[model samples]
Target chain A: MAEPRPAILIVEDEPEIRRFLRTAFGVEGYRVVESATGRRGSIDAGTHKPDLAIVDLALPDVDGIEVIRRIREWSPMPIIVLSARVQERSKIEALDAGANDYVTKPFGIGELLARVRAALRHAVRSPSGTSILRFGNTVVDLEKRTALRDEEEIRLTPIEFRLLAMLAKQLGMVVTHRHLLTVVWGPTHEKDTHYLRIYMKQLRDKLEIDPVRPRHLLTETGVGYRLVLDE
Target chain B: MVSIDKQRKPPAHPFSKIPAIFMGNLQRSWATVLRMNLKRHWVGYAWAVGAAAACTFVGLVMYPRFDLVNVAMVYLLAVVIIALRFSRGPAIAASVLFVAAFDFVFVPPRGTFTVDDIQYLLTFAIMLSVGLIISRLVKSVRRQAAAQAALEIEAETERIRSTLLASISHDLRTPLAVMAGASSSLAESGERLSAAERHALAKSVFDQAQEMSEHVAKVLQMTRLETGAIKVDRDWASLSEIVGAVLARLGERMAAHRVIVELPDDLPLVRVDATLIEQALGNLLENAAKHTPPATVVRVCAQRRGEEVIVTVQDYSAGLSDRDLERVFAKFHRGSVEGAGAGMGLGLAICRAIVRLHGGQTWAERVPGGGTAFRFTLPLEEAPSAPLELASN
Candidate 1:
C-alpha cells in the first residue's frame, strides 16, 4: 500500500502570499488546501481535516485566531501561524491557543519549511512519548534527569537539569519562558525568565558541542526556547 | 529669546523711516495698553466700591468706642486687603475710596464730609500714600508670580520639543547612514566581493530601509494618536490572539529572549480595537526587548481581575529607577540604559496613547524580583454574546 501525501491547509488573506505558499509547498511534495479568508479557512479546516494548518493572524473575513480556536476545539493537528513582523502579541496568542509554531512574513522559504518540518515531526513523534531524546552528540535521559555527551556523563546543577528536562519533554517544540519557569521554579516564579536563561546557558554549555552557537538548546529570541533534536 | 528680540526690533527696511509706519506702531502699542487698563480698571472699581461700603459700616459701628485715628486705620486695613487681592489698579482705587470714606463717615462732624482739624488732613495724606505704595508692591509680586508660571511652562515645552527632535534625528540618521554605507560599498566594489558578502551588504541596506520605514510609521501613528485622528474601533477580541500575533510578528528578534505567555484559557474576551491593542502590546514587547539584555526572559501575562484584563510584559533586566518609571511613557523620554540603540522613544508613548484611547490605563513598575514590568488594563465589560467577526466587509 502506498502512503498518502500529507495535507496542509494554508489560511492567508493575501493572494500573493497564498500563491507563494502554494508554490513553496508544491515544491516540497505536500498536498495543500488553500483558503483566502478566515471563514472559508475555518470551514475548509473542518471539512478537509488536513494533516496540518497554517493560519494568518490578520484575515479578511474571520480572524486567523478564531480559525485556530475553532479547529483547536476538536482537532489536535499541528498548527503553524503566519504573521507580519509587528504582530508579536497575536503570535503568542496563537501559540497559547494550541498553535504548534509560527513563521513571520517576509520569511525565507528555507526557514518556513524548517519550522513546518519541525512542527510536523513533533506532531508525529510526540505521541510515542519518547523517554530519551538525542541531539547531535548529546543524549538526554528524561527518566533519569541526566544528560550525556558521547556516552560521558555531563554535570548539571538542579536548576539546569530541570530546564533541560522541560526542554526535553517538548523536543523540537518551543517551550515558553512562563512554561519553563512555572514547571521548574513554580507558578509564582513565572516571570523569572532570567533564571531560565542562566540555566539554559549552563545546560547548553554542558550538552552542546559549542555553547556559543548552540544547535540543540536553540533560542526563539523574544518568543521562547526550543530544543532541536537534530540540527 | 534672541529671535524674539530681533522680531521686536523695527524692520530694517527703508519703509521703517516713513511717518505712517512709525505712527501705526505707536497707535498699536497705545491701544494694547489702553485695552489692558480698561479691563483691569473695571474689576478694580467693583472691588473699590465693595471695600468702601464695608469700611463705612465698620466706622459707624466703632465710632463711639474707637477714636477717629483708630477708625481711619480700619480703612487702611481695607486698602491693604484690596491691594493684596487685586493688582495695581484696584489697589489705587481702594486707597482713594478709603480716604474719602474715612472723611465722610468718622472724620470731624460725624457722618458728614467735613474735616475740622488740619491734623486729620495729615492722617488722610499719610494713609493714602502708604496704601498706594502697598498696591504697587502687591502688583509687582503678582506680576512676578504670573511671569514665573509662564516661564516654567515655556521651559518645559521647549525641553520636551528639543528632546523629541534630538531623538527623531538620531533614529532617522542611523538607518540612513547604514543604507548609505552599504549601498556605496556595493556600488564601488561590485566585482571584488564574494556573492555572500554582496548579499550581506544588500541585506543590510534592505534591513535599514525596513527599520526606517517602521520608525516613520511609528512616528506617524504617534502623531495621529496625539491629534486624535484614530478612532477606537471597539470589537470583541481574543486576548490570546493578540498575544500570539505580537509574538509571531516579533519572530527572529524575539528569539534572543524567552517569551513566556500566561494568558489563561478561561480569560474573557475584551472589547477593544484589535489593531490598536495589538500595536500597544507590540510596542511594550519591543521596549522590553530593546532595554533588556539579549537572552533574558520576557514574560507576557494576562489575567482577568474584576472587570478588566490586565496584560503585563515583564523583563528580567535592571529595573527602571523611580524617575524613569514616572517619565518612561513621556514623549521622547529615553531611559538611562546605555547603548540602548537609536530609538525615538515613541514606542512607550504610543503604547500609552493607544491604551488611553481605549479607555484603558498603561503603567510601568519595577517587579518585586529585580526587573521592569509594563502593564496595561483593558476594560473587560460588554463581551459580545457571540464572538465578534472583526474582519472588515
Candidate 2:
C-alpha cells in the first residue's frame, strides 16, 4: 500500500473557494497547492504532481477545459473542472477534453472535495491492480463482483449494483452527476440525477458506520456522492 | 479673367436682371450662342460678320429719321443686343459700327463719318460689361446645386442603415431572452414529477425555446457578421463528443422526431469551437424541424473526404426553390412561405457566419430524392488512432 497522506492541487482562481478547499483538504490530512490562472495552475499540476487537480473553466488567459486537455496530454492524472457555466456544451467539452469530471459553480464545498478525492482515487486505481475496497465497515470485491458489510453479505438491486460498480470503477474519483445518471440509467436518464440520492441513501443506510453521518458513503451534494474508505 | 470695365455686365438694377438679363435672354441668346461656338472652334469670323450686318441695317434706317440722341439710343440698344447674343469680337464690331453710324447721321455733322463727341463710347462698353456678368452667375449656381444634391443622397443612405439596425436590434433581443430563459428554467424544475409529464414539458420547453433561441441567435449572428464580430477559437476536439453533446442537449427536441445519425466508425478529430460548431449544427437541425413536417425522417450524416468532413442534415419535406437557394442565407430571408412565422428568421444567416468563422463553408440545397439538405464542412485532424478502433478491432 501507499503512504497514509496524499497531496492535492487546488487549481481554482477564486480566493474564498480556494481557502475553503485548502482547509478542507488540510483537515483531511492532505497537502494542498493552490493556483489562480489556468496556465499557472497547469504548471503546478505537473511540477507538484499532486494526486488531484480541481480546475475552474473560466480563467483570465486560458479556459479551464483547455487546461484539462493539456494536462491530460501527458498524464492520466484525475482532473475535475469547476465551472460557473452550466452550459451542457461546456460540460461535454470538459469531460471529452480528458477531464475526469466537472462541477458547476455555486457548488457545495463537500461536493468539490468529494469530486477531487474521487478523481485522485480513481486515477490511482486505474494503473494498479485492485486492493481491498472498503468504505467504513463495508468491503467490495471488484474481481468477484461482491460486497459485505460488518462480516455479512450485502444484497443490492441491479440499479444499485450498477451504480456502485460505476462509482467503484472510479474508486475515489468524482464522477459527474450527469455522467453517473447516464451510466446508471442511460443517456436519456442523464438529467435525472435525483435518482442518485435515493440509491445513495439505500447504500448509506445499509453499509456506513453511521447512516445519518455516513463516513464512507459521503454526499458531495449538488455534485454527486463520494465513497471514502475508513480502516 | 473678366472685367466689368464698362463693357461686360448686366445693368445693376434688379428690374434690369429680368429685362436686361433673363427675359432679354431670348433676344440676346444669339450673342451667347455665338460665344459658345467661338470658344469651341478655332475661327469665329463668321459669327462676328453676322452680328455686324444685323446691327448695320438697324443703324442705317433709324439714323436718317432720328436726331443724334434718338439715333444714338437706338444704336446703343443694338450694341447691347449684339454683345449679349454674339462673341466679344462681334460685340466690338457692332459697337464700332453703331458709333460710326451715330457720328455720320445723328451727330451735328449729319451723314458724315465723324464723332463730334466721345461720351457715347463709354455707354457701349458699360452695356457689354453687364451682359457678361449675368451669364457667369447662372452657371456657378447650377454647379453648386448639383454638388449639394449628391451630398444629400449619401446622407440619406446612412440614415436608412442606422434606422434598420435600431429596429432590428430591439426586435431580435426580446424573443431571444424569452426562449433562453424558458429553457434553463424548465431544465432545472421539480424532480419528483413523473417521466411522461417531465419529458413532455422539458421537451416542449426546450425544443420550442431552442427553436426561438436559435432563431434569435441567428438574427444576432447576422448583425454580428455585418458588424464583423465573429471570431474563431481554434482547438483540437473529438468529433463524436461534440455530436454526442449536441444530440443530448437537443435530444429533448429530436427525441420526438426520429433523429438518425450516421458518423463514420473511424472519424478523425476536428479543430473548431465545440460550442459554436454545435450551435451551427443545432441551428441547421432546428431549421429542418421548423420547416419540415413532424414525424418525418431527419437524417444527420457525417461523411469524410480526405482531410475534411461534410456534415449533412437532410429532411424529407418540400424543397426550396432556385430563388430560395440563391437568397436563402441572406438576412431576414425565408426558405419558403411555409415556415413564415418561424423564430426571428435568422437561422440560415447565423449558420453561414458560424461556418465561415471556422474557416469552412455552409450551404443548403434541394435533395434529389425530395426535401431539403443542409451541409457544412469541418477540416478534420488526423489523430494517431481512435481508442474505439483499438478496442473494436
Candidate 3:
C-alpha cells in the first residue's frame, strides 16, 4: 500500500499565480487543485478536503480571510495566505480565521513550498503546533532550539532561531517585515524592517550558497521576505 | 486665500452687479430700467404741455409781473426730470425745449417764436450746457461706485476665510497626528504573544488607526491647499529620484498594491519642488489604492516628450466616466458614487496646483481597458544658470 500524498489546494485570483502554484506543488508530488476566486476556492477546500490550502488574501469578490473563516467553521485544515497588503491587520485576520500562516506576493517557488509543508505539519499538530524541518543540507529542530547544516552543528542564537522558526513555520510563503520583527525583536522592531536587512544576510550566510545572492531567503521589495525551501 | 464659501464674483460689468448689490430695495435689471423710463414719459410729456400753456397764458394776458425768474424755474424742473429718468439722447431734446419756451414766452417777443433780445439768447445757451454736464456726471459716478463696492466685498470675505482656516489648522491637525502615532505604537506591540493572540491584537489597533489617519491627512491637505501659500523651493531634480522618494514615503500604502516603477534610469532632471512633488505623488498613490481593487497593478512612469518630462500614474481599476475625467482635478470634486468613500478628494487637485506652480500641466484620462490614468508633466532640464566651465579648467 502506498502512502497518501498530502494534497495542497491553491486559491488565487490571477491565472499566472494559480498556474505557478499548481505546477510548483505538482512538481513537489502533492496533488494540487487551483481556484481563481475566493468562492470556488473555498468550495474546493470543503469538497476536496485538502490537507493544506494556499490562499491569496486579495480576491475580486471576497476577502480571503472570510473564506478561511467559512471553511474553518467545519474543516480544521491549515491555510497559508498570500497577500499584497503586508500590513499586520490582514495577516492577523487570515490566521485568526484559521489560516496557518501568511505570505506577501511576488514570492519565490521554493518559499511557498516550504510554507505549505510547515502549514501541513501545523495542521497535523493542531493548536500550539511546533515542528522540526529539513531543507537542503540543513536541519532545524524548533522544539530543541538547534540547527545543523550538513551533519555539522550550526549555532543559532535564541533570537536568530526565533526568526528562523518564524520563517520555518510559514515556509513556502512570504513572512512580512512587520511579522518577523514582531515575532523576534518585539513590536518596537516592526518598522525597523532594516533590521531584517541585517538579520536576513545572517540567515543566508549561515545556510545558503553565495549569501550575497541568496536562494532560500528572498526579498519581495516593498513587500516582505519569503523563505524558499527547495535546494 | 481661497474662501471656504462658494459665492462667485459677479461679472466685471457694473450693470450685472446692480441687481444684487443695489442698496437695492429695487430689483433693477436693464429691462426694469427701460420700463421705468417708458412709464415716466407720459407724466413728463403732460408736465411739459402744462408748462407751455402756463407761459403762453401769462404772456397773452400781458402780466408785467411775470418776469424771467418764473420762466427759468419752470424750464429748470423739466431739465432735471429728463436728466434723471431718460438717457443722454432724451436729455438733449429736453434742453432744446427749454430754450424754445424762454424765447417764445419770456425772451422778448411775448408769445412769439422769435428771440427779440440778444442777451436772452446767451442765457438760454448757458443753461443748456450746464444741464448736459450734470447728466453725464450722474451716469459715470453711478457705474464707478457700483464696481468699487463689489471689489471691496470680495477682498473683505477673503480676509475672513484666511483667518478662520489658520485657526482651524492648529486646532485640528495637532490632535489628529498625536492620536495616530499613539495608536500605531499600540498595534505594533502585539508581538511576543501566542500566534492567535498576537494576530488578534495587531488587526484591531492597526486598522482603526489607519482609518483615522487617512481622514486627518485629507483635512490637513485641504486646509493647506486652500491657502495657496505653500512655500515650495524648487531646483533641478531627477524624475527617477522623485518617484523613488514618493514610493518610499508611501511605505504603508504601497504595501497594499503592486507598484511597478517604469521610469527610465537616464531620464533628464526637471526643475521642481522635490518635497511638494513627493507629497503630490503620495496623494496620487493613496488615491489609487482607495479606488483600485487590492493587488491590481498601479504604475508610475516618466518620459521626456517634446522638451517636457511626462510622468503618469496608472491603475488597473474601474476607469472613470467622461464627467469624472473632466472634473477630476477640480477642488474637492471627489468620485462620490463610482468608488468607495475614503479621504476627501484633494489629491489630484493638489497635483494640479503643484504642476501649474512648476509652470507645467496635469490631466487625467480613462485607460481603454478598465482603469484611470493620471498624467502630469514637468519641463525638461534647462541649461544650468551657473557659468559652466570646461572640466579641463
Candidate 3 achieves a global lDDT of 0.68
Q: Which stretches of candidate 3 lie over 4 Å from their true place?
A: A1-231, B1-226, B336-338, B383-393
lDDT of 3 by residue, A166-203 (tens): 87666655566667878777877565544565456556
As a TM-score, model 3 comes out at: 0.39
> Could you report the DockQ of all the candidates, in the order they appear?
0.02, 0.03, 0.01
Rank the models by DockQ, top first: 2, 1, 3
Among all candidates shown, the one with the greatest lDDT: 1
Assess every candidate by TM-score.
0.54, 0.40, 0.39
Ranking by TM-score: 1, 2, 3
- Please, what are the lDDT tens digits per residue for candidate 2 over residues B64-147? 675556655665566556555544555555556555655555565567765556775565455445434433444466668888
Of the candidates numbered 1 and 2, which has the greater TM-score value?
1
lDDT of 1 by residue, A1-231 (tens): 297888999998888888978999998988999999989988999999899999988887887888999999999998888887453467777887878788876567777888888878777777644567786887877668777888898766666666777776666777776678788888987665445544665566677775545667776644577877765
TM-score of chain A of each: 0.90, 0.62, 0.59
Write model 1 residue lDDT over B1-393, tens digit each, in one string: 434544688658766557555666786887786678768677766878998998889888998888877888888888888877776767766777788878877776767878898897897778777777887887788889999999999999899778767777888898899999999999999789999999999888877877777787798898889888777756445666567656766676688888888866567767677678878999999888888888889999999889888999999988889999999998887787656473888999999999998878988999898999999998878543321111211
Worst 10 residues of 3 chain A by lDDT: A212-221
